[model samples]
Target: MSFLNTLNLTGKDKSVGLLLGLILLSHTERTGAKDKSNVVQKGKGSTAKLKEIMIGRCFNYLGTINPNAGNKDCSKLWEAFLRAFSEKDPCKITKEDYKPFLNMADHDIPIGQSIFWSQTKELILQYTDVTHKVMPLENTLIGFMLDGLNWCGKLSSPGPNYEACPEWNSCTNHSMGSFWRAASENYAMKAQGEVTVLLNGSANAFRENSIFREIELGKLDSKRVTSVHLWIMDNIDGPDKESCGVGSVAVLENILKEKKIKYTCVDNYKPVKMLQCVFKLDRPSCNTGT
Candidate 1:
């Protein structure tokens, strides 16, 4: 028996089967094309997820303090948690939101003291890059700083962490780049992030000492600088040294304004024991080399 006749179907039935086969072939082709287009989109989505995973893992690893504070196992768990809850609402406030604050006036109620927002931005950037990879610098400074101080537990209480060590006055502690990066990355809502001016010794006498040093060292160029946060530290050893004085504030403000540099002075605010300040510069317009 011939293959066509073996089925014992009518001529109409044969034609119907042939038509169905053609339809199936066409459908297969269309499905394949759709899948090909989706491949590119899928790859992009996968890459974004992978980047997030890498950053979160690295950040967790660097932030680890004690032998058990954050282990590799803890990081894996944290990663899973973040992935599950990764859908952050755009309305939620983030650290970068402080960039606009430089434009706000000094007397602006809440904005006047919002030092944490910008600082957190600096911290985040330091830890994660555009690809979300954890940078080594985060490991060295923030990690070491946290680890040495025992961070959360140590800084929380008035123990050795509160002790006024000579290290606080050193370049490492006062470095703008390090401070900026750490501040930008810190995500804690409770962190003071407020700029504090420690006016010790003669407040007016050496109010501009740090600023002058920065300028002399060619770190700060008056015209190129857009704004600067002032931290006036004086007589750190004196009995009443911790008090933020009025004279320092007046002198620093007058000098900064006279230089045509938009600025804000945050005095007597101590998030931690350290006196902190922030400075903003117009990168493109800055005559000073970055």
Candidate 2:
């Protein structure tokens, strides 16, 4: 099916798409005032500052953050990461810690619970499964409200049409998929110029899309991407082994290599396996146009 058709465009879908489309178009139209547009803004931490948070704390704290894992230091790191997200300040965290904290805040936190600041904190503490809890790296359910979700922004639900799924748990990773959808949706909304969506039956989804190659050629604009975060939510047999599920870091690594992108793996900030790998796409990758 064509991309538009594949979107499952019903009347409601079209209307929603148009609304988002208008928002995006408005940002692009102001290209003349690009220097001053607040629609997008740079993240607070530098590459070096981010590195300190990730390698120093996030990786080190791993299992402990799960609360159920019985690791005191880990719990501390988890709390720190959660706080960084809620505060939008990475003073204590390093590069590694930023991705998961930001991702969870961006995609995983429920929109309804986002209203009250205390409520957001409560949800993070509640969902953490120290033993096997799949805490979100991003609050993917909030859709276009990612910017609004930032602690600095006006906090509220996206709209009346937007609500947390009632049967979220019964639906595939439950709320996890919602988080992914939100991240992907946020990216599409923030992108300027052309944004292409592709699906491949091939195991190498990245290759089929030439995502890395396109980025290198500058055909894929960097300002739109912000940062790329991934989660490997699976019961893999072992480390360096297939999880029987797709989207493994090994696959992403190979694609990055093929495209010759200069990427550094952020360490320490979050659960390595659960939060998995995060990549900083050279310059302007994480700008996300604010």
Candidate 3:
């Protein structure tokens, strides 16, 4: 029997099935096209917008950091930043590609106030917001420029490939990861006087492969930075597994000793705990910490 004869459908049923099939096919094709189009548009628009904001932030940051620095051509800064990764394979971008961009606005961080963090992003922001005493990389021009923004480009594409980009683990040389590593290195190299690193005390505070331990720590110039102060902070309620002489912290100390870098570790630093309390007011630790 032919396909239609096997269905034993009346003329009306056959017409209805053909109409439904056409509609489904049409919908499928449109959905596929729309998805592809959205990817390109989103990627292109995101990069463009980021470039505009970063250019403005760069100049504003320069003025704040150096009142007498005078005006800089931010447009040129945007161009240099774009040139680093534009038209390149997103998976193949390298840290060195960002050197020119980094050189454009390199400035000395205030001595003793440079802060590094591994997994304490929220607390760091809160501490800096309240005290304005420490400057995390995100506060610096390079960090401010790229933090939280994702962009990747393909040689054949007109702009960043927004629809899908490699995740950090997907490629060793992913574009965004490379940029941050390069930025972190630059930030570390400029450290002078006492440098502070905020670590999560609840877990292994230091890891052999973390950006802080691997990239930033190694990049720190022992001669330039007077000392490395570790603020090991714990969750308001909890099982603090790592501290000055325990777990990963001990390993880090040995590395510092091997490098001859002066260092100090303060477990559950009071001020950091206070900041945590601001966010978690119900926690007893916040109100009772010394």
Top candidate on lDDT is 3
Candidate 3, 12: how far from true, in Å?
60
Task: Give residue 154's lDDT in candidate 3 (0 to 100).
Answer: 61
The per-prediction tally of clashing pairs is 18, 41, 0
User: lDDT of each prediction vs. the true structure?
Assistant: 0.33, 0.32, 0.79
Alpha-carbon error at 53 in model 1, in Å?
7.9
Candidate 2's TM-score reads 0.21
List candidate 2 segments past 4 Å from native: 1-183, 188-250, 257-260, 265-290
Give the CA lDDT, 0 to 100, for residue 40 in model 2: 29
Q: Estimate the TM-score of every prediction.
A: 0.25, 0.21, 0.79
Superior by TM-score: candidate 1 or candidate 2 = 1
The weakest ten consecutive residues by lDDT in model 3 span 37-46
lDDT of candidate 2 over 1-290, digit per residue (tens): 64446566778788777677678778877753642322223332122333244334433333333223232343343344444323221122233434454344332222112111111232233334332333233222222222222221101222111112223233232222333333343333333322222112122333423422233223323443333332222211212222212443356555545544433332211343232222432323223351
lDDT of 3 by residue, 162-271 (tens): 56665666678878889889999999888889989899988878977789988999888888888889899987787778889899989888988988889999998887
On TM-score, the candidate that comes out on top is: 3
**Model 3, CA-based lDDT:** 0.79
- Compare candidates 2 and 3 on TM-score and give the better one: 3
